[model samples]
Every structure is written in C-alpha cells, then in structure tokens.
Target: MRLDGKVALITGASEGIGAACAAELAACGARLSLTARSEEGLRKAGPGALITPGDLTSEDTRRAVVERTLERFGAIDILINNAGIGSYLPSWSAPLEEARRLMELNYFALLGMTQLVAPHMRARRSGVIVNVSSIGGKVTLPWSTLYSATKYAVNGLTEGMRVELWGDGVRTMLVCPGYVQTGFQKNTRFGHAPDGVVKARRFAITAAQCATAIRRGLERDARTVVTPRSGWILVALSRVFPSLVEARMAKINGTA
Candidate 1:
C-alpha cells in the first residue's frame, strides 16, 4: 500500500485521530476524501480534501461519500473506518437506545462503509481497509463495557475481512490504540469515564503519534497495529492472567 498518489477515504475526519490521520496521509502524498459531522472541523483538518460533512450512520451519507470519492479520484486505494463514539455506562444498566446508537456508529456504520467500498476495491484487486479499534477491544474496560463491545466487534470484523479479502488482494488492518490524547472522553455519547482513567491521559500518546503508527502500519502491510507499542504488554497480560487484569480494571473503575 504505497500511499503516494493513492486515494484514501477517511471517516470521522473532524478532529482527534481521524483528523490526525488525514494530515499524516496527505503528508505521505495521498489524495484525501474526508467525512465527518463537522464541516468546519473537516475543513481545518483536511485542506484540499474532498469533504463530505454528514452523519455516517445514514445510508445515504455512506453511499454519497463513496460515490463522490470515486467521482473525484476514480479509485479508492484505502478506506479508514475511523468514525466511532464511546459510552461509559455499564452494559447492564445503560439505556438500550443509547447502546444501540453507540453500536450504530461504532460498528454498523463502519461495516456499511466497508461494504460500499469493498466491491470497488475487489474489482481493482487492490486496496487496504483500516479499522480503528481500541485496546479496550483486546482487554475490556469495565467502566466502558459497551464501548469496548463495539471495538471488540470491530476487531472480529477486521480479522474476518483480512482472511476473506486476501484472495482478492485486499488487505485489512486493525488498529488498537491505547488512550490517545484526544477529546474522546469529553465527547463520549454517555457518562464520563472513571476519574482514574481520566487522569491516565498524562501517560497517553498524542493523536498525531497514533496517526503516525497507522501510516506505518499501512506501509508495512500489517495485520494488527497497537499504538504506543507497549499496549501489547497489557493485551498479553490480559490473555495470560485474565483474573489479575479484571481485578485491576475493576479497581480503575472504582468497583472494587
């Protein structure tokens, strides 16, 4: 996936990781098509990009975004499924509607965008799909269980796409980022994260750093990318010592 001169469509390009990716990809000489709910923020984040400002949860918006990107660039060499929202409510107690809405954007919308672009990529037999999941997807966050669920779904889908699309010459990459410095906490759709988790921002990587990792992953044709690298240690620990990890997470959520 040489980014130079390639057409990359990125969702959630308004601010945070998506915005950072837009800039990073452009710097790598990729042509950009950016979509988000904020027209103004997209403008700032992706200058000279084909901006489609709308809700990704809408089927029409998803279609128009893919159609318009092809209209402008003639081909989509890369798809970055980055548009997603978070929830802090416990899965058992959260409103069903809120949980549904979270899944709609974080999981369903991502799947919809992939479905729309996958055919074109398969036709060409060349493309990369990048799904922006979270470290929470690998090791669940007790405080944000619902949010973690969406990311876990993303991880599953990305893995499946990798195998399913490999014969077509299409590659899929899963990005699991640990606490990137962004407004994600402030902009979550539901309740706030526990104070301990919020205070952990001091140790988090910047969105730009996360974006850089994504770009590197694309260049190397990686299957999975865990930003900050060290996040993998946590993931490994969770797998080898599930009860220990759960206890620590419960403490972070102030539940123990």
Candidate 2:
C-alpha cells in the first residue's frame, strides 16, 4: 500500500487515467516520472519529478522512455503501461495504416516496453507492471472491433507474462476498466460508435475511480483488476453466465 520513495513510470501521463494515477501515486508517496506528448500537462504533475514528452507510437520513443526513467531515477520499480489509443470505426472501414499505428501503440509498443523493462525487473527479481486495458478486451461488441482487438491483445499479453514472470519475482497485471469518462473515447481515431453509445459511455466511472482501483491492484498485487462495482459485477456475471451476460451487453450495444 505504501510506495514511499518508489520510482514509477507512467505513460499517457498527460491526462485522463494516466494523470489521475500520477496524482494518486504521488499522494501515495512515490516519485513519478511521467511521459506524454503534452509538456504542459506533464509539468502540472510536478513534485520532484521528471517529465518526458514524446510519442509512444515510436519504438525510439518507447525505449527512450525506459532509458530516461533509468537515467533519472536510477532504476525502474513500477511501470504503468497506460498509453493507448481507441479506434471508433469498423475494422474494414478503418484505414489500414491508421490501424497499424494503433497497433504500434496499443499492442506492439506495450509489448516492446514490457520486454525492455522485464529483464531489469527480473534482474532485481521484483517489479510491478500494470497494463491499462479495457472491458471490451474481455468481450466483443458491434463496431470498434479493431480497438477491442488491441485491448484483447493486451489481455493476452498480460496473462502470458504472468506465467513467464512467476517465481522470477516479477508481477504482471492487467487493469480493465469499462467506459471510463475520459477524452480517449471522444478523441478516438477509428472503430466507429453510434452517438447513443457515446452518450451512455459518458456516464461511466470517472478516472479517479479507475485510478483508485489501480492503486489497490498494485498494492494487493492482483492478477487482473476491474473498476467500479458495475464493471466487476458484469465481468463476474460474464464468467458465471456468459450467454446471459452476452445477451445483456448486446442490448447495451443496441445489437439486440
């Protein structure tokens, strides 16, 4: 629970879940090294911190983040892979190249960053990775298949990682949140959504609520974490009665 003096690196730290996490983690007493494309936003997270403004979609930028974190903090202890993009169009309708870019950030960059950090954690035999995924990773819906697919990839990555890191003393976890009230959805590039869907999504849990759940997951070292009572209840029900849950979610997506 206490992260006093721990060095943490947070991607997508300019705003939304990343910024909220920076605030929460800083309050928990950890020094933060935050990265995003926004220098101004990163500056706002200050309190004995280092901020890096770069595109996470670039391999060079991703590695530089790790290198900068190490150079600034001496060693990386916690990595919150919260940087990602959402596509709001149908996969086929979406631009192939744009989707590739999405994959670069949502899947490949996360994997590469983890690969870069895991060995260091393995060397120390201790570290925590909190990959920010989404509830759509756990199920399918109408449009947004590509966006969902990327999150699904994150889900798979997190699971396989836990197996590999076991007994190596490295902890890997996936944090899946449902319709977090953030600019991510509004600013999405593809994976189309109806206006009704967007409206409903706006009323979902706040970033702070999701960040609180993330802090708990890090503290407890959870395998997978979900935010808000409704989110977990749905995930649980999906496991308990998949068909029923699917039928219900279908209605929510207006697919039924």
Candidate 3:
C-alpha cells in the first residue's frame, strides 16, 4: 500500500485535481505517467513524469498511453481515471449530441482505460484503480442531471470492478469530491454559472484538498473517498432522506 516507487498513470493531468494527484503521488515517491489533451498544463506534475497528451476518448490514445506507460515503467501499480467532461444545462433541454459527447469522455473513456489497465494489474496481483466521480454521483443535482448520470454510472462501474478485482489483489477507489476550486467549472460545456452556481462556488474546496484525500485513501485501502470530510453527510442524507435531499437540490438549482 506504500506508494513509494510504485508507478501511477493519471489522466486529465493537465490541471486541477488530476495535476494535484500527480504531484502528491510523486511526493510519495510514486513514479508517474501523466496524460491530458495538452502538454502545457502538465508541467505542474513535476519533473521526470511521463506525459501522454491526447484525447482519452479515442481508443488509439488510450492504448498508446497504457503501452507507453508500460514501456517506461514496466508495470502500472496504479491507474487514476480522472479525465472527464461535464454539462451544466438541464438534461431535458440539452442537445442529445452534447450529452452523448459528455458520456464519451466521462464514462466510456474511464471504462476503456480501466479495461486496458486491469489485466496488467491483475497479472501483477497488486494495483489500485481510482475513479474520480463527484458528490453529484451520489446525489443527483438537477442543474447538471446528465453530468450526474455519467458519474453515477462511474460509481456503479467502480463498485462492481472492486468486487471483481477483490481476490486478485487489485483495489478500486471511488472518489466523490464535493465542489472544488478548479478550472473544471470554466471548462464545462455550456457551463456558464447561473445565480445558484455562483452562490455555491463560494464554498468550493481547493483541488489540493481533494488530492490529499485521494492519496490518503490509497494508503488506507479505502473503498470510497468523500472530500472535505463533510461531503459524506450529503451522501448519507440522500440515502436516508431522498425526498428532502431532492428538495434541497431543487432549492440549490433555483427550481424550488
């Protein structure tokens, strides 16, 4: 469970939580392979980290990233599927194509990368797969329904894979972070902040905080990580008081 000298491949490493995870893991002495659509922002991952800059939604890109990571490190001890896209519009009014595009990057790309890396992890009988979902995955947010749906799928996939890989000595961690300060909101498709979103941004945590939780989860062999320590209360409320939770979400989305 010690990350020292272990090789970790992190997607969406150009910035935000992904970059933070790379830096934290490197500080833990883990060798890193960082991937993103652009190389410029990846420099924050620090020196000597392998950078695979490309579109992760493409099969060729996923394959190349894995192959090259293996080529350099000989084995992947950890796989962090962090590359994702999000939508801020209401699902019913959103363009169908745009929804599908979000799914392609957020869900399918995560699945594709896991599939490519799982066998190697299984063969080695020791590895970790971290899927970066969201607090929205645990509790649907009306304003970003489609984005929530994609993350919900990731939650399910990670849970199932965790059980499947249990006996193989491979581990899966579901990271459901509350709102964090990052360029994520700015980069989201059709993601202009509305009044409610603007109000919510005031409470967002920093990306480094989320990254710290992820690293600690890996060390402790945790199944789920809810960042800022308090996000878990929302998850619990969603489970025990679904109606109330939905009402709160409605209020937050300015629909109440």
Assess each prediction's global lDDT (C-alpha) against the native: 0.95, 0.84, 0.91
TM-score of each: 0.99, 0.92, 0.97
Query: Evaluated with TM-score, which candidate comes out highest?
Result: 1
How many pairs in model 3 have backbone atoms within 3 A of each other, for residues 3 or more apart or on separate chains, i.e. clashes?
0
The lDDT of model 2 is 0.84
Order the candidates by lDDT, highest first.
1, 3, 2
Candidate 2 per-residue C-alpha lDDT over 122-189 given as tens digits, one digit per residue, 9 for 90 to 100: 99988998899988788765556788889989999999989988899888889988888888876676
Give model 2's clash tally.
8
- Pick by TM-score: 1 or 3, better one: 1
All candidates in order of TM-score, best leading: 1, 3, 2
Q: Write the per-residue lDDT of candidate 3 for residues 1-256, one digit (tens) a residue.
A: 8999999999999999999998899999999999998888887565789988899989999999999999998999999999987688888888898999999999999999999999999998989999999998988878889999999999999999999987999999999998899988789866665578777888999899889999999999999999977988888888999999999778878789
Q: TM-score of the candidate numbered 2?
A: 0.92
Which of 2 and 3 is ahead in lDDT?
3
lDDT of 2 at 16: 93
Q: Give the per-residue Cα lDDT of candidate 3 at 2.
A: 95
Superposed model 2: Cα runs more than 4 Å off: 239-256
In order of listing, the candidates' clash counts read: 0, 8, 0
Model 1 earns a TM-score of 0.99
In model 3, which runs have C-alpha deviations exceeding 4 angstroms? Answer: none
Of 2 and 3, the candidate ahead on TM-score is 3
Question: Superposing all C-alpha atoms, what RMSD in Å does each candidate have to the true structure?
Answer: 0.6, 1.9, 1.0
